[model samples]
Target: MSTLSYETELDKLLKGSNISHDLPVSQLVERALERKEGILTSTGALRATTGKYTGRSPQDKYIVEETSIKEKINWGSVNQPISKEVFENLYKKVLAYLETKDEVFVSKNFAGADIGYRLPIRVVNEYAWHNLFARQLFIRPNAEELLTHEAEFTVISAPGFKADPNLDGTKSETFIIVSFEKRTVLIGGTEYAGEIKKSIFSIMNYILPERNVLSMHCSANVGDEGDVALFFGLSGTGKTTLSADPSRHLIGDDEHGWSHTGVFNIEGGCYAKCINLTEEKEPEIFNAIRFGSVLENVMLDENRTPDYNDTTLTENTRAAYPIELIPNCVIPSVAGHPNTIIFLTADAFGVLPPISKLTKEQAMYHFLSGYTSKLAGTERGVTSPEATFSTCFGAPFLPLPAYRYAEMLGEKINQHDVQVFLVNTGWSGGQYGVGKRMNLTYTRAMVQAALLGELHSVETVVDSIFGLHIPTRCPGVPDEVLQPKETWEDKEAYDNKAKELASKFQENFMKFDKVSDIIRNAGPKF
Candidate 1:
């Protein structure tokens, strides 16, 4: 039997339209520049602006409620359900729109680094830069793999195609709908490149857990001795920054799956926050922006050098670069079971301790709570640090119940005897306005101590409200700063803030009624 060709599969979607299949990175970059899709910055990075939609439009995203996976889905405000009829109509429309186009670019890649569980994906993009974006973001297939490649899932992205809300049964012109039964993702109306990356993540989140693998939205790195550490956090909590440690080998910056054998990265690249990026602070990420990297929504000066401090377009400015660009990244992006799991939180309220040890039950509680502040401009219309609770650190991408993931994490922690720590990279001394952000050096030192097991014998003091075992004697951090209450001039005010935050935690936990009582009881008590 003859092997299926990439062009043949792409032709089925093209409907006789011109197709550009698996173009080399150089050609893709040349085509993107010729099309005026983006400009080459002085640093040799391609800076592209996602018109109208600088960030993800979660409200416009949907999943087809087909019979096969309908009941399995945790249908809610996040996983909004659309009818099969609606999906069919939109899918047909998207195909027709593509057929009318003069040309389209296609790239074939895999989503997981572990070959056994990897998902073969073919991304069809109407824009050249988007093809480059997909190439950099997803794991590229080698010549041998490409020859036999059959896309298990396909993403048809046409940012120029807008939807009619009334006619299409959509919320707005922008739509990102996933059809598990069809094994296809249809993205239209928004040009945000992250939509492509996250669509695959959502699919993995749904499929991996059923296979007994725990898929996570976190960052992972391994020490010199091969001890692995996982960092779980939402935007602005330093998951990317802290995980890119020079001394350690970076397994991946985001999206990983932990199976029985070990942990593997889901992405081939890093989508790092570029706002206020500097070579002095993050040399690896800053330097990784040269050639082949795609800078999204970042401002460039007359000299075409990126203005990292500029947020005029959006604070959610990002750079997408392949893992190899980072000097110390681990190839194949897989590592052994993690010895330490860190839950990073940017507590705008500033009453939480800088770092604390977590009991298994507490780990489950915080995992479900997924508390963090939503930094400005990460999403459309978001302008300030708003208290947000995303179950499992990435609720938007999750299709199953929050408890399902928390249950998997609990089992993994026990099975591996993994030490869990909750590190607050947010505010201290006072709330957001009055308090300063936690010092990065102190946070790094605390994390280092945890990774090296230096905190095992350290003295701890319990926070009465939150019940976290705050370490009193971290090596490099000041004694006073370890305790949130002591760092504040007004202790009474700190007490009030702690209770308020504790009450918020309880309120959030109320939504997860199906969680175990042990986990519920482990939460903060006012």
Candidate 2:
């Protein structure tokens, strides 16, 4: 299909009476129920199951091989390539399948919150709930902004349209193909709404960097005195939990860009994990789930109330809501250059320090390392903690080479003179099975101490293995807990465990051969 052919078909679909453009939340919820797409929970959140595919189908994701971006992308297993023809065929198929639907949902909005850097985006969905998901997850344009909005990137998602792996060059029935030349994303065969959200993130990760903005997968917040902080970590590392402090105004929960002027949110809403969510533990996120919010794969009780602790469907259960729902959220989701950067890690090995200040070299090393751990029983795997390192804390969404983003971060840190800290929220005395998880109260205290400058210029002791500058004591935390080695019951056992974990760090950092010697020496000494 030529550009004109697809444009004509898409224009016909958009101009039809069956197309619903920017329908209010109430009507979309009504349409979803009428179509039996999902059920409304007692809290009025629309609960939708994603069938067998409850999470992202990374194996089926691809980037079209266009000449312009061929040399730019980090082409490997992480970024699989498909010919341009395959993308065009799939794009046509998705659009054609959407035309056959009784109604299609369209949403036009922006990605970045900063007016100068924002990317105008449009989302076309085959399901009403999906449109609502897009509405709740992406930026919602005001009436004035909508008047002149022209989408720079358009996403077309048709979950009912499955690809033929053999015929369509897809790995499976699912496909998430992005064509950089077309500025279009085509997603199919996955009812999981996160695909719709992350697809645009992938686009921003590519586009923003070219515009001299550093795109990041992190949560940000602003303090009372106007200090901005960034929390970087992979899933289950308490990035969301720590960033949503009632004392601080949230800038955004995920996806942001650091432009020449300052930092700005790339999303208008938050997609929070709802598994085991409780009001006492996370009142902000819990209360945010309301009439317009979309709840994915969450089980309901007999009274139609959400079972936050239930994981029968999936532990990846989530809540999607606009940023306005959070009482302490910054309206524009913009902040100044970060005064502090915290790299969070759930180190199940229990070897990393609880709170350790980082040098610029160490910060760059750990930022690129992006280390975290996967606890046992989290997936279908064996019962043990597995070390997981995602470069820059977000490997899957980054479209460019890892070095591109790392170099950008190094420059930003140097220019801003940002203070960086590595905080371990996973384990303390021993490894996962033996040692318990870090105390939430103590973790909060340590984070607060760092944010408030309580630990700056404080007494410190360097770790023998990891070489992290650990604070001697924190305000509300126990003195012994400050040193992980002191809390261990067996002295010799702790040494062996620490050495094993240190060696893992050394091995993982080996992939970055091009990294400067100063940054390389910042890793574990073992």
Candidate 3:
């Protein structure tokens, strides 16, 4: 069948009473409980388990090779390409499977917070809980907007539909296929709801850049003076924790777009990590988990209260809640262009400065580098912390060339005179097992100094290896703590470890073929 044939048929399947259209959170949660799709925790948040798959199946993800995006996509292991026939076959299977269900859920929403740039989206899920995940994660349209809504892109997720790899042309029974030409994302076999959220982000990563908007994988907030700040980091890097400042109004916890006018959140809600969660550590997130929020894979004790520390299911436990649930969240989730940018890294090696100012070139360099560390015991055969570098801070979601996003960021930084910094939230004094982690109080103090412009004119000393400008003094932090080597018991060991990490940076940068000499020179020096 032709693409139009399937598109025309989808409209008919979605309009009947068998489709629960635009259900509220209460109705969705009720349906989910009645259907036994999930259970309600003591806090009133619904908890659902993603049966075989607890995380994203990146290897099985694909983008259809169509004439429109044929020459544009960075096509590789990250953005794999499949044929139109394969996508059509799998998409048909999913829709037909949904037809067999007692009922399906649908939601009409927007993606970008900026009205001008917002992309109208429709999500159709075989599970009620998944639809709730969509409604909470995406920008929910008002009643007036929904009456006139027409989705430019559609996501059809039927986790019950399992593909036949041989006949279905899939890497596995689980597959996430995005057909830009068809304006649809077809997910099957995997029960993971995060796939639904990320698939849309991957699509936005493609669509927004074409409009000259730089889509970013970062958390944002605005100070009292309306000075905006951006925090870029991967999971476990404290991006969410740092951006949840009691003093600053949070713009969004993850995924934002920078257009000519200013910064806007791409998501209507925040999906926070729930492992090791505590009210004392993240009070806002703890309080936000009431009534309408959705929790994934979090264990519950006999009293039906969530055990945030339990990881029997997976370490990637998450909770999705509306942005407004956060008391200090910006109403429209919009802000002026960022005045400050912080690249957060948990450098376990304990060599980088606690906090340091960055030059434009260095910012671009580090932005592209996107460095972090994976601690030992987190994975098998890992006896020590390992270096991790994801380009543009979000390599998995970037469908376009890495340099495309990097160039856009550089242009924006130059145009707005943005100040960027690298803050290490990892171990200090020595590598992971040897030293204590950087104090959260001190980390917050250093970040506050940067946001308040306290580090702007303070006396600075340049690091010999990485060329980062370290602030000599910071409020609420001892002077020695600001210097990594000064706190270390053995100074020579610090130099050796610093050099070791510098080599890893050089090795990772060799993959980029388009970086310029100036930005290239901004990395660590031997």
Report the Cα RMSD per candidate.
2.8, 1.8, 2.1
What TM-score would you give candidate 2 relative to the actual structure? 0.96
Candidate 2 residues 241-284, lDDT tens each? 88888989999887899998889999988888888899988899
- Local lDDT at 365 for model 3: 89
In model 2, where do residues sit more than 4 Å from their true spots? 374-385
Compute each candidate's TM-score over C-alphas. 0.97, 0.96, 0.96
User: Backbone clashes per model, in order?
Assistant: 0, 0, 0
Q: lDDT for every model?
A: 0.91, 0.88, 0.90
Candidate 1 vs candidate 3: which has greater TM-score? Answer: 1
Full candidate order by lDDT, most accurate first: 1, 3, 2
- Model 2, clash count? 0
State the weakest 10-residue window (summed lDDT) of model 3.
374-383
Error of 2 at 414 (Å): 1.4
